[model samples]
Target: MARKKIVFVIVEGPSDQDALELLLNKIFDRDRVFVHVTYGDITSRAGNTPANILKKVQAEVGKYAKNNHFEKSHFKEVIHIIDTDGTYVSEDRVIEDETVGKTIYSPDSITARDKQSIVERNLSKRKNVDKLQATPLIWGKIPYSVYYMSCNLDHVLYNKQNSSDEEKENDSFEFARKYKSDTDGFKRFISESDFSVGGDYQSSWEYIKEGKHSLERHTNLGLCFPDSER
Candidate 1:
């Protein structure tokens, strides 16, 4: 029998990997997809940034090719999913004068201009290296909060503020507990979501301000799915 084709997905952490694994499995045969966690943020000096992660991916592909005596073509796609973390601003920066509510500086607080600047800055810093250009890279702008009904997955899952990193790890499982049980419903939610005007961090912030879950709605995981599934 021919070996199954694999799709590689590099995520920020285990929670992200878990959440995507559930969705990917629904869209394709479980055996055909592989989701990996970078275990840290892109800004960190770890194997998580776009350039470093791609290196890891290439290494893995090489290993598989050597082990199985197969060609690198065995892999179909290499997708990178990362959170914008509110345009790389520190969450400690507090918004002091909001009368309606004590709003903090977050990705939701960033303007379109600032968001674009941040994206450009990050991209500029990316090392010039060859990547799997045919792959589809998805950005989860600001964070996964854009996906879970416009709320932070940590707060929604654990119902607490200032959650620990370990607590945050459970986000995917909690999301699956609610959303994955009804696969078709979840699929419809993803397919019909229209969260942003322009599908960028600034647009996501606008939708978030309107008390909408637009970010979660606009997240594009379609590349991981088959045409029929999408």
Candidate 2:
């Protein structure tokens, strides 16, 4: 049997694509899942715009579909992931469980908050919500693969009080802090939560990783991976 080809387009940088590739290669099994990932201007402030991202995605998808001998019908089934850091205020907050979600900045790093607490603080609650369940957003013909974290590379993950190199390797928090502190670093995150087009890359990648093909109003989602029985 021939493997299915899925095209993934990210806004910019390699992180979004790297994360998806990790998940695909490790969790989804690469043998049956053929993937082509493209990195556009996901990291840049200008390229993160919804219109620009969508335009690039459409062009790439169209090109691949034609090259792969896929017609409009098959192209309709192709999934697109346009990652964002969720820098927008609207997308950053979602009222779930009577709590408003927001991003908070620490001395060394920034992390997302569900109401007053960090997302990690409510890991138990995260289990209740299906991790894979996607929400179709009003970005374009594509739904996003959203991972709106509070911290970018600029934010320190480990020690907010101290930003020494010794503290970084011990914990992820410190590492985040170092990245954020760097000059023109990718520490500041954006996504559907926030309005910055620059932060939309990760969510976009997540969209394609889950095999979501956005067409017109109605979306083609819940397409299960070959190994995972949905």
Candidate 3:
């Protein structure tokens, strides 16, 4: 049988690109799959979204194509991994606002409560800090997954195995892996937390911890970050 074609991913940062690349590698055996994932600095400190991100993607791909002498057809398909925070003040709400900061309880205070509770509370505050809008039609051709999550930069970069200072200093892939891992944690944290004003944090926490299906969902999605899948 013919080998499957490789996929190209254009991401917001070098790290973002790496994370997905890692996931693909982990899920698919190296011998069976091949992927070329690259990233460009699509962020402006201004914020990123589908509309604005595509511009960056085009420019980066153009540069890569020019330097490598490759055509768009060289790859099976292109996937633009972008963060969709939802809502917008401009084209595609793909970007984020840096000037604002939402004050949620510190992680230290929340750690004493429950992990799931902390996740929901922080995620709830994401809207206040940044406008996250999920947009389709990024590449104008290829299908992609534009992840829309609450702005949790610290978790995104800090809580994963790939996030060691040593890894970050040495390889860009390590940094990206950490960020991707955080995305998984964030998802799990929120899904388990009861966003309802009076919901019990403890109950939700137990459901996430003891419930087989719930834990599996989190791990499956969480493992989406991938370690060696590359």
Candidate 4:
């Protein structure tokens, strides 16, 4: 029998790996893809950054080709999934209100300048990876993509859209947690959700870039699986 094509993916955490695993199962044959989670915290090590992930991917591809005595084309795709958390602004940034004699800051808040800086920094990182001939699927913030599927896992699984913003913010983790015990349930929820309604890869990429799917949902999962059955 012919060997199945391999598509490699690197993600930040186990939850991300699980979610992408489920998604890839839908897009390709179950045994065709491999998802690796770095569990690297971006604050210190640039966890799952495009360049870092691609380095590992290159090593893996090299090893695989050497073992199989085949060319790199034996692999179908090599992709990275990164989260845009503190990349937008330093988490240490804070403002002092002299009038009130207090410090005011929210983890979720980003100034216009900070936003621009973050975007530029991320783009530069991506360009560095592209120079290495690998592209990544970046998720703006942590839960934005999960939010695109529904307000939260409760909303996606139970049709309950009443989750608070805080709950919604952590929905990706919650969904990943649930996926561990109930993989089928999560798969079922995904099958019935409208997460892929924005046409094909390029269209969805444009939608996310234009901030239609939430300014935070700036991911390229669509591009990673351009021909995926949606």
TM-score per prediction, in order, is 0.54, 0.34, 0.40, 0.47
How much does candidate 3 score in TM-score? 0.40
Expressed as tens digits, the lDDT of each residue in 178-200 for candidate 2 is: 44334223213211123222313
> What TM-score should be assigned to candidate 2?
0.34
Clashes of each: 4, 59, 15, 0
Model 1: CA > 4 A from native: 43-71, 88-107, 110-163, 194-218, 228-230
Minimal lDDT window, size 10, model 1 = 139-148
- Local lDDT at 11 for model 1: 63
Q: Which candidate model has the greater TM-score, 1 or 3?
A: 1
Question: Model 1, range 84-154, lDDT digits (tens) per residue?
Answer: 33332332222234243322222234233244443453343232111222223322111111122222333
Which residue segments of model 4 deviate by more than 4 Å?
A: 22-27, 41-73, 86-108, 111-197, 211-214, 217-230
**Backbone clash pairs in model 4 (N, Cα, C under 3 Å; residues 3+ apart or in different chains), count:** 0
lDDT by residue for model 3 over 99-126, one digit each (tens)?
A: 4343222212211224443344333323
Q: What is the lDDT, from 0 to 100, of the residue 45 in candidate 4?
A: 48
* Alpha carbon lDDT at 161, candidate 4: 40
Mind giving the per-residue lDDT tens digits that candidate 4 earns over 1-230?
Answer: 87876666656565455445765655666347767665553322444455464445455546655776756555665555554332333333322233532222233333333444445544554344333322332221111111122212233333334445455446655555666666455444454345533455445444533322322323334434434442
